[model samples]
Target chain A: MIYVKELCKTFRVARRDGGMKNTLKSFFHREYTEIHALDHLNFTIGEGEMVGYIGPNGAGKSSTVKVLSGILVPDSGICTVGGRVPWKERTAHVAQIGVVFGQRSQLWWDVPVIDTFTLLRDIYSVPETIYRRNLDELTEMLGLSQLLRTPTRQLSLGQRMRCEIAASLIHDPKILFLDEPTIGLDAVSKIAVRDFIKARNRERGTTVILTTHDMQDIEALTERILLIGRGRILRDGSLDALKREYMTERHMTVLCAGLDADTLSLPAGMTLSESHPDRAVFSLDTTVLPVSDAIAAVSAQTDIYDLSVENPSLDTLITHLYKEYEVG
Target chain B: MKQFKKVPAHRLYGTFFSMHLRAAMEYKSSFLMSFFGMTLTSLASFFAIWLLFDRFHTVDGYTLSEVLLCYSVILMGFSVSEIFLRGFDTFAGQVQSGSFDRLLLRPRSLLFSVLVSRMEFARTGRFLQGILVTAYAVTHADIVWTPARAGAYLLMLLGCCVFFSSLLILQAGVCFFTIEGLEVMNIFSHGGKELGSYPLDIYGSRPLILFFTFLVPLACAQYYPFLYLTGRADCGLYALTPLWTLAFLLVCIGVWRIGVRKYQSTGS
Candidate 1:
């Protein structure tokens, strides 16, 4: 339901040297440096697809979201959300999309959360029946019934984030753009948000484009992943495909009754990463030697008391990917 | 299937207005303090005008009531616009805080959204003061009130409101480019209200009168209409000169549109 091609946005930022004399000189002749916030970015998201947009800081993730959500006009590119150019037909295009900026709020402060919802209802021209239905459903799902009456400024951060999500969904937008929705949330709140998003995607088929630094959020909520860096899309594929490519090494931790310290010989595919009195951590290249073979090889030298083999976590794989792309 | 009925702009604005009222009511003590404070400050300015009239019985060949009439018209117009157009007055804050991005995400006119985002009901203090002064002027000024004069008076108030509102909009449009409100803009918005308190011709300068008459159109709402209202001008067309403020409104909207298209939202 979203198509973007050759999207480019450059920002001219003012620069000035420190010290009073330089400041005075620069005031008369200001200098600027152009930063490419988005550079020929291209991606297509299908309907009902929840995609994780992962990138490091200043990677143009938020810039891309702004362009698609009609908040920023790109210098040059063609972007159509559900067949409407966002910046060209903003009022019409925004009606079909919901956006939640985790760091920013859309709810009115010093007023009950419900007041903002009703204002949004009127703003989007949602039908009374639909508004009621959506409000009831969101209240139940987000556990907002108790919090709706509280002023936004009085609510805790997690409570406010839930209300922010509900406010965005009041109009039942077909597409949802969540920029770092799980940031600054406790574990329980994060899981609650992730579960609600997953359920919403499953039940209502809402297309979700989520950008978050939390790898667990990506692992739990999205099937497809779009990795961007330096204002360009570096990788775009299914999460499992990325895992398959980056998960070639398996970490093996073995607790053994070690009788020798420096006299042990290891196989070519297995390298001991860490060693202790009775425990040893091995990094095994599973492509060269399978997990079973690696375990058997370790068992030959030491009396194994306990053993565990694990694939690297998603966080490690992302860090590895970022390093591979030289984005960090 | 039930049809989704579209809410009219007026009803939506009413919703916003009532919400602002409720929000303001939350801080009753602060609201009252500011309301009275605003009244007293405006009264001080009116007191200055009263002292001037007392010292000079007729300044520029106009009676005290005539000057009071001009002052009240400008004062009432300014207060009305300040009450309703406060969003534009404080728009730089919205842009700086990135809240303006939220407005663009809604399915409504950006101008309408911004217009309803804020309202300074506290300015009703100045509005009431204007009414009191207008009442005193009407009772004391010797002028025949015909239907045309009444119409001219009503149009003058409306034109003045539009004139000030356009100035606020112009300043708000400038915020998109500069990202901060220019203090120089206050010279026109606040300064015009002070200068317009007296009839433009009383300024005794041709360029000053022409600047307000054609360039900014402040005199169109005050001077020309005041001339027709007081029977000083026989031409019926002077009464309609207040309509020129509409042209200024169009120009401001054009600038605002350009600003919106060129908007570069700050932060993520």
Candidate 2:
């Protein structure tokens, strides 16, 4: 549904010293430094794919989203979504895509949330029947019935987020670009939003590209991730594949009915670190021994009450990805 | 898709405006007080001119009634422009506050969204005051109003409105590039009204041409058309000089388009 090739965006930034002399000099002649916000970025997302757009701060995540949604024109690139060049055919392209910038609101502050939706309905020229169907489904799924009557300024952050999601989808857009959609929400609201997104992907086949720092959101919603750094795509694969490849360590905790002992046998690359009377912890290097092999070896020697093994977290995986790429 | 159905853009604007009005009404005491306060300020502007005429009986041989004719049109046009186009005037704040991004993402034209999303209802009181002043001017000015003359006067009013609105649009378009929209834009918005309230001819040849051609097209919308209205100009087509106001509007829009293209490159 989306194809980006060698997409480059560069910004001309003014450069000046901090003190007074340079500030006055800047008024007469500005020295500009060119920063390439995006450099030869390449990615393609298929229709109905729920892709996680992962990156650190200033990693061009928002810039990529802006380009795809037809908000910004890249300096040089070929980006086509659904057979249309986004920036060139902005109105037509934007009609098929929905964007939610979690940092910003698209709703009118003083009006009831529903009124803003009504305005959006006219804006996209959504048919009456289609609008009602979408509104009904969203109101039910997102628990937006209560929010519709409240003016947006009066709504809580979570409530406003739910309404923003509804407002974005009023036209039944084919693709949804969510930029940190669950930011600042309580756990309940976060799960509610996550579940609603999953349901929308499943039921409506809406292709979702979600950019977020919250790893749990990635874990819960996306299987495929586009790991980006320094305006470049470092890895594009299934989340499981990433965890298996770069997830070098596994943590295991053992709870025993008896006293913790030093007699436990560990494989060559694994070591036991902490021990209490009835519990022990092991840090196993997955590169040297697979998690299953470590588990098998540990189970054989222990009179264990219970043992739990944990994979490297998505956060660690991402951190390593950034380090591995040395994205700057 | 749906045969390009007539979008309810205007009706939506009405709904948005009324909602904004309701919010304004929540501070009912302030809303009412500001409504009167605006009219009083516009009255002060007229009194400034009236007092000037008191000292000098006539300006460059133009009588008080003739001056009022020029003065009333300036007041009405400026008030109308400020009432409807205040968003553009204050768009630098919108850019700083990140609300301009909201306009960008909406499926409407950016210009229309900014124009329709907000209005100053308090300034509409200034418009009413301008009309009252114009009524006083129209009755006192001893001029024979032929049907064509009346039409020219109406056209001049509309042309002035268009001229000033175009200036605001140009100012907003430039804001998208600079991030800090120039405050110098206010000089044209306010100064045009102050200067256009008198005869442009009194301001010397260069000032007359500058006002006729650029900055605000005040001469096209007021001076030349008023001359024809007052029988000071013999050519009937002089009455049609108000149409030049439209060319000024077009040029402003063209400049705005260039600024918008620069904005696309900068993405601010």
Candidate 3:
């Protein structure tokens, strides 16, 4: 559904120093530095795939989304979505794609959400029958039947985000480009949004390219992850592949009431430290020391109340990706 | 199963106007206040002349009625442009808020979307007052009412509307290139309305008249047409000078296209 090759975008940013004198000097003679927002970026997202596009701030994530959505024409390279170039065939290309910029709304501020949706139906030329069907489905699924009649300004952030999602889907677009959809949502709202997105992908075969700071969103929805930093696509592979590569050490905690920590039979490459009277922490190279063997060693030494092995969080892995990549 | 689908330009325009009407309805008090305020405020322009003629009895050799005819036409032209083309008038807001991006994303023409996104009903009341003032001017004027003369007045009104709208469009279009909207464009747009409220001849001719005539064609729509309407002009060609406003308008659209190209290239 999407194909991009060597997609490079450069912006000429005027360079100016701070302070009143420097600002005045800039008015007389300004210097500009060329910033490569996206450099030799390449990725292919197939139909019906929900991929999380995550990176640190100013990592060119929004730039990539803008380019793909035809909002910005790239300086170089070819980006094709559904066999049409985004910038070259914007009308036709955009007709098939839905974009929701979390910071900017597509709906009119003074009007009700439904009014904006109705206008969008006309703008997109969606058939009346199809518009009704989609509106009904999206409204009910997003729990937005009540919110539709309310003015956009009156909606809460969570409520408005739902409306934003619904607004984008009014055209029944095949591909959705969500730029930070879950940016400032509560945990419940975030999960609900994730569930709704997953359901959309499952039922309609909608292709979703989501850019977000929340790694949990990636863990929940996308099997594949695309990491970008400093205008470069550093990693592109499945989530487990990334987890295995960066997160080599696994930790386990055993909870035992009134147990001697030294009695724990530690694995060869493992060290046990008492965190609490009931809890002990052990480290193991997940590749060499199987989690079950380490757990068996602990259970043999102490009467276990409860125990669990935990993989490093997706957040930790992503933070490592950020530091390793040194996202500008 | 449908062979084809389309909304005719007239129908599209109807939809745009109705949507704006609905939007205006939502702001009932603001709409009503502005509507009343525009009518009263626009009347002040005529009162300036009414007070002047009260003192002097004439501007140059033109009487109150003749100058009223000129002011009415200019006011009518400006009010109509502002009413329908307000989207262009406030294009800076659209660009700054990024609503312009939403406009470009639609399948329809970007120009049409900008026009539809905003339509000020308040100016319609002002336009009605201007039209009424012009009608009063026509009753008092000495021109013989031939069908051709009637046609000329209607055509002149239309040509002036297009000309003013074109200026506003040209102003908005320049915002694309600069990434910032310039307020000075209003000098040509809003300022033109104020300037056209009188006989350009009173400002003296020299090269300015030639510049406004052959270049911008403001004189065509106002000065020459006013001369013909007031019996000062003898040639039939003078009656048709209002048509030059259309050509002048097309040039503005051309400039607008270049600005759009720059906007796409820079994408700032």
Candidate 4:
């Protein structure tokens, strides 16, 4: 279980102007700006829960991860993992958690992947039997058998990412914190990672807090989403709830074979997004007009061959949330 | 069901050293070239001193072999510390590259992790050269080989290692305050070796001797111990002067601890 209440963190950034004159000026008297990276955030994640932490760049996502992982001490906050303060009991807290930074390589560059894993086994003081069991299962699950013998630098990005995930889980951490875990992998690699994460959460009951820009990763792996923007928790709900709350408009696309020439007239509050001789797309706001009425109105104007109705995608839903919250 | 036990620090360090040695040996050609290159460069310094002595039989009542003893001890201390403490020497770059963040994520001591992340095996070339110089000096230097004198010599070598390691740690601690490394710290590390190559008395400067004796404690490791070994100072306490270097190591570690706390708070 994890509980964070009113956590706040601020960073002081030095300001300097360009060119020799300003650079010399800064040498004498430098300006500084205070950035509130985490401003009074409150969230609690229950055991065996998989939550996606979503935010734009500079949105304090990584800052939150660092604080939870015991890498950074916040200025003022009450954050605890199963009653232990991460920053205060760093070594013990870190031993019970796993972290994967997608942009960084935790494995040694020149050494074989197995060497890094073995080193971590000792570093974490995992029992030999548990180490062997985890190694076997992870190797088979991640398809890292042959790749383990090769140096990490030689592996492709996809293969390296798999090893990175496996490396973090060698100690069988109870809580897994993934910062952009599926950042740059190909489709297959991404699916493999997501499936593994989902399976691990289901089977092992590992508490996963993932932060990623890839919406599909959130959709595939997490049922709950926590949207953060401008150092504040903007929204927290299920994927279905987000769709229902933001899906005031429904998009209907019609594939009509022969109806043409500026003929069809849509009902009030419905707008045509795209139009062609063979196909047309219309946006309907459900609050103003019913879905049944929109269907009848479209059928009255043109001979409808094929029609499909859908809500906005996760990408559009998030964009709408960002706009509603007025966060960049 | 079982009590958790962390790996002993010494055992973990041993594993780190073995892994580093293995990694270094992976690049056989580069390792050999640098190893030989260091020995050759260090040999050049010895010849420089030898050439100066060839022209003048004694500088400040110290013969050529006596100077070699001092030079070789400093060389051994410098190279030995470099072998183990090169991690701190390169700590600033690690912090910049965010590798220091990776180090902090682990459930181990940050200082130990940094110390183990790097080990300069190539510097063995300098260490070997120092050993050779010590062998040459021991046979030639005119001194009675008392057990206390031999102990003083070994202690002086250890002191030199600790003293240089302290300098490296101090520099690393400074990196926490300024992410950009201070290159000026090298003046003390490299300059101390150069200054310690000769008898401290030859400087003929009281402030210089005192500075080395108390601040960096380089002269305590070389000069006071050398006085006892050469029978110049009859005091038994001079043989124990290298103990001061241990005190210097303690101070360095204390500063390094403060830096670690600062890093956790600042998160830079």
TM-score of 1: 0.96
- List model 2 lDDT by residue over A1-328, tens digit each: 8999999999888999999998999999999998888999999999999999998898989889888987788999899998898878877777788989898898878778888888788888887888899999999999998889888899998899999998899988889999999999999999999999999999999999999999999999999999888888888999888877878788889887654455766778888888888888889997888878877776677677888988777788788888888874
Which of 3 and 4 is ahead in lDDT? 4
What lDDT tens digits, residue by residue, belong to model 3 across residues B1-268?
A: 1212544546767866776787778889998898899888888888898899899988889898888888887888888889888998888788878877777677667778888878888778788898789989889877787776776677668767887888888888788776677878777777778878888887776687887788777778888867777778768787798888888778878887777666665566
Q: Could you give candidate 2's per-residue lDDT for residues B19-129 as a string of tens digits?
A: 678667666788889999988887897888899999998988898999888888888888888888888878778877877766766667777778876788877788998
* Per-model DockQ against the true two-chain complex: 0.62, 0.53, 0.48, 0.73
Clashing pairs in 1: none
TM-score of 3: 0.93
Model 4: fraction of native contacts? 0.67
Best by DockQ: 4
RMSD of each: 2.0, 2.6, 2.6, 1.7
RMSD of 4: 1.7
Candidate 3 at A119: error in angstroms?
1.8
Indicate whether candidate 2 or candidate 4 has the larger lDDT: 4
lDDT of 1 by residue, A1-328 (tens): 9999999998988888799998999879989888998899999999999999999998989899989999988888899999999988888898899999999898889789999999999998998888999999999999999999998989989999999999999988899999899899999999999999999999999999999999999999999999999899999999999988888998899999983658878778888889999999999997788889888887888899999989889889999999999996
Misplaced by over 4 Å in model 2 are: A255-266, A275-280, A290-307, B1-9, B204-211
Off by over 4 Å in 4: A257-263, A290-292, B1-3
Pick by lDDT: 1 or 2, better one: 1
Candidate 4, residues A23-122, lDDT tens digits: the string is 9999999999999999998899999999999988888899999889998898997999967999899888888899999998889888889999989988
Best by TM-score: 4
Give the poorly placed runs of model 1, Cα more than 4 Å off: B1-3, B264-268
